[model samples]
Target: MVSKQFQFSCACGALLAAERRLAGRQGKCQGCGAVFEIPQPGVLSTAPRADAIAVQEVCGICQTAIAEDDPRTLCQACDLPYHAECWVENLGCAAYGCSQVNVLKVGPDIRIPSPASPLPGSRQPGFPQAGQSPLGASGYQGGALPSAVDRAAASPTLAWDYLWMGASAVGVFLSILSYGGPSAVTGLAALVAYAFQQDKSHWGPAATSLLLSAVGVVFGLRLSLLFWQAT
Candidate 1:
């Protein structure tokens, strides 16, 4: 006697057999690793169900009815059956009004994610938390760059301390060679340039230039006096 059975399908076209009592329960497929819910048992009939028929149906593409043991393929979108060879020849689903082009390989489908899985748009694993910018830890607010970037942008005036220090070094070298007036004036002017920069944020280089220029001015005056006395 033929045993009563409930038949269902996976998204990958794998046919599944389930007991009548196991209906509405979740189970994994043997052919494919797909998790699916077992369909409720329908009324027993000698003839097959219109949609969920067994392998004993005629191929929609080739019109040849296949035996129960013959290999077959079924359309997941339309539940239409076709012989495996005919399905390959047709290149896709043969059901009317269905436009599916690729035959699905038996694998995972209709998956129900576990409860522990991270929700979409939530902070992903190893990613920064909310209110933190990817660019840096500071100089930004609400993910926007701070206005100080625009205020402290590259300026020609910032280069003054560097140029003044160079000019002061050249002045000191010239004063050591007894060229007094122009060398002393150059060192004094460099000191003034450094003074203006001291009130700004670049105090380190400004302070350095201030000390060097003061020493250069003193050296220039002493050298000029010794040269004048010798003449």
Candidate 2:
């Protein structure tokens, strides 16, 4: 015959069982590492009472039916039942206000929860907290740092830089036919494009545009001066 066991709970909400002979002895709670004196005989029951069995309780974490014969434990704080596996998977009691909500390892995995992981009901890595907007209070979405591609896409001056470059090219072509009048505008447009460009990769193209605009200005001015002197 199997010897009878006595069931007791720790202050941290861990359910513990010991042989009936070990009653009134000191025991340590595996959940929070708290040592406490075990209650004497008749203080706690080994199994759920008849009324509790008839109610068909569910696991607090998974919300599934817990069979009468299934391995389970109860949270000492809120008196909620949880499956043995569910308790280990969730790391502790799933009740919201229970003190053991963040308590680690009521089950076999005795290691503490990693600090990098967020506790239950807390904000996740990519999510916004309470009262925060979708883009977050800091204006970045998903709480992630802005990447190079993101900065490039959001740059307001990039469009203006390209527009100035295009204007510079058009002005240079006009200077070839209209003498020095268009060269002045072409040189100014090229200077603005070069100054506003932020990306280092485009520096070579900007320099080329500036040089070509300068040459156009000089050529047009020389041609205009020569023609005026001859006429």
Candidate 3:
């Protein structure tokens, strides 16, 4: 009697084939560790047999040419061969889009569970079970909290360009009362800081701050020059 074969594909591209009896059972993809159900032969649309394709002489993962005598494992799903070391290192089939684990055997009866065995369910690695939340089974109820970076970005204290512009204005007022030195110094400092930080600073407000600081320097210098001429 000819034995029947069932084949299916993992989303990652690994082709899987087993005895038809393994249909509807769960198995993990050896390549990507993805869990999936083995579909009944008819459930998946019929396609060309991946194993029917011929493999090249080069190892798929390492790209090194395989010597005819080099020990290798051919993926049953794709019929591609890799150096034994390459297959072990990659942990699965290395054909593009296929991540199924390397197989030593390719017969129908190799890995089947008895009908009495419970079928396994697939689950995401880090996700909690049904009805459970990260905080607790009851879920977080204290209101969603903002991240520290978000809070800092929203803080008034972070208005550095505004603060610098205010300082420049004060410096200009002081210069009019005294000399041009304060205004010139504050203006230059603000301009340099703005140049260095403009990319990361509030663009619109920083441009305004730079403009104000420049105007303050010009006015203070003009007043100081007139006062100097009188002296």
Candidate 4:
């Protein structure tokens, strides 16, 4: 006996098919990656087999006749048919202005219940409600909390700052003793530190380290020039 298959549309508008035995089971959409329950038999309107309608139906994305037994899907928004691969490749419905265009997955429609109004004279112990002075009840008179950027800017200097500064100073001392090779290496270290610190949003330390490193590099270069001139 041939197993019957049922067709249904995913929330993201992709057409899907499942066997009768698989009805009411959760299935994932291949085209848009949505997980949905396959409708039980008689619940969803089943379409005729692709083999029976191959002559008239074509894939919307490739404009090619859909072959019998080929994996296929339809855009729920516009009812446009597409090969499974074509639908996934195009990302969503190819029809212009279709709500499912480029949509990977559609979330379930959820209705949020509005907060109930408090009964008169009943106090909820928590953060101050709208229009209530935070200072009056919570004693939080420091004004608005610091933003993320402000907190980042106010962050204390990291250990890497000291390491970079020390390396630069050592390089400057070594340059005075040698001919400035160590200074170049330390200059690169300082530059790396600046980039790392700047990426972490430690602007003050990054700038300070870079400035000191620049001075050391210039001093080292000047010494190298004098040493070479003497030679």
Candidate 5:
């Protein structure tokens, strides 16, 4: 509720921090038999959550640090930390920031088998995904991959569709003049090439416009071939 300045190591040998203070559950350490007195503000710390492997302890909910000295028994899903009074409702730990608003508590019975079919365009158009990491342990090898920014900076996927479409435009003109049948093929090829470009260069409105232009070129070529062939 409030980030208070308190440090009370459970005399039961549990840790506590300035932002997160807890009374030993029922005045006794649940993990180890110990009693704790809330440490004074200056006696406790206000540092970022730190561990050997976990360089940072950010709450998955509010993205706040679960301070290093604080009891980590609290779930990152809730922002509110456990206090001497409210430890009971928290299942007896100092869970913080995870109010469970957008939480889906997974268990053995409720199995989430591969994203329930993504709801046909329910993805947020162009947003980075949520929970996009392996938790607890790295079960697979070489699973860690580069981020979007890293890939883009390394070797940008260029707009090759423009080159193909431009060449196809010349082919379309040549087909109208000489190879009338091939004119349709060239225009169709332009559309196909543009589709490939759409897959990679979905950067902004400009790339979209280029892809749409390729489509328009296909229509125009088809129309010209029809009219010219008829005459």
Candidate 6:
């Protein structure tokens, strides 16, 4: 779910055909540029994507180009393409402190070991295989981001999020009904307080902050007008 198809190459400057997924700590491709999906795992392809290059299906790990006639269902975390059997035999979840949950087969399998699923896409995001970026990056590329990265990016503060949402709503309500008084100021202050607690490092918090602050400002202006008229 968090995985994205990166249109860029690995941390190295090699040109890769398939999109790269973030894996490991470095956010680089699991195999980086050295490993690639192909007829063989250890074997490297002279041609990145042969003749306009179509991997048919990519390894979902490394950004390698599988050979036209190769047999493999998935690639290692490093992006080393492997046949289904090779994947089951060689690669599995390696996260520490997580048993039965971390190591398991993709989709479903008896040997890989995972909770059986009755429907497709039933698995949640942030799994080990998700969010694997290539070892590193520098320029622009197109591809879905890895699931892990998304989770790492998403900071869950349920209470804080709710608090801010409530404050913002109160601010809106005051602006509409009170026409500027304690209610208006209350909304303004609440909005600012809520914004400070929001997580915008990953998304565009700055923009939201500006927009919300502007609304508060307008409320304050209306309040000033009301008080001035009373004077």
TM-score leader: 3
lDDT of 2 by residue, 157-201 (tens): 333334334444555555654575555654554455445434434
Candidate 3, which ten residues in sequence have the lowest lDDT sum? Answer: 121-130
TM-score of every prediction relative to native: 0.27, 0.26, 0.29, 0.27, 0.20, 0.24
Model 3 earns a TM-score of: 0.29
**What is candidate 4's TM-score against the reference?**
0.27
Q: Taking the tens digit of each residue's C-alpha lDDT, what string does model 4 give over 4-122?
A: 66666667665566666656544556666544555776543345446321112456677665566789987888776688899988888888899878876444565555555432222
Q: What is the lDDT of residue 120 in candidate 3?
A: 28
Candidate 2 global lDDT: 0.53
**How many residue pairs clash (N, CA or C atoms closer than 3 angstroms) in each of the candidate models, in the order given?**
0, 0, 1, 0, 19, 34
lDDT of 6 by residue, 172-204 (tens): 444443453333443344444434432333222
After superposition, candidate 6 runs with Cα above 4 Å error? 1-68, 72-85, 89-164, 180-184, 187-213, 216-231
lDDT score of model 6?
A: 0.37
lDDT (10s digit) by residue, model 1, range 44-138: 44444546533234467765555567888877777666788877877778765786544544436757789655433222121111223212311
Better of 3 and 4 by lDDT: 4
By lDDT, the better pick of 2 and 3 is 2
- What does the lDDT read for residue 127 in candidate 2? 17
User: What order do you get sorting by TM-score, best first?
Assistant: 3, 4, 1, 2, 6, 5
In model 2, how large is the Cα lDDT of residue 170? Answer: 54
lDDT, candidate 5, 1-231, per-residue tens: 445434444454444443434422222333353333333345434443342111123332333444557554454554344332234333443433436532433446876767534432223232111212111111112222334335334323321222233434444444444434344444444344434332333433224434444554565567766877899
Clashing pairs in 3: 13-97
Error of 3 at 57 (Å): 78
- The pairs that clash in candidate 1 are none
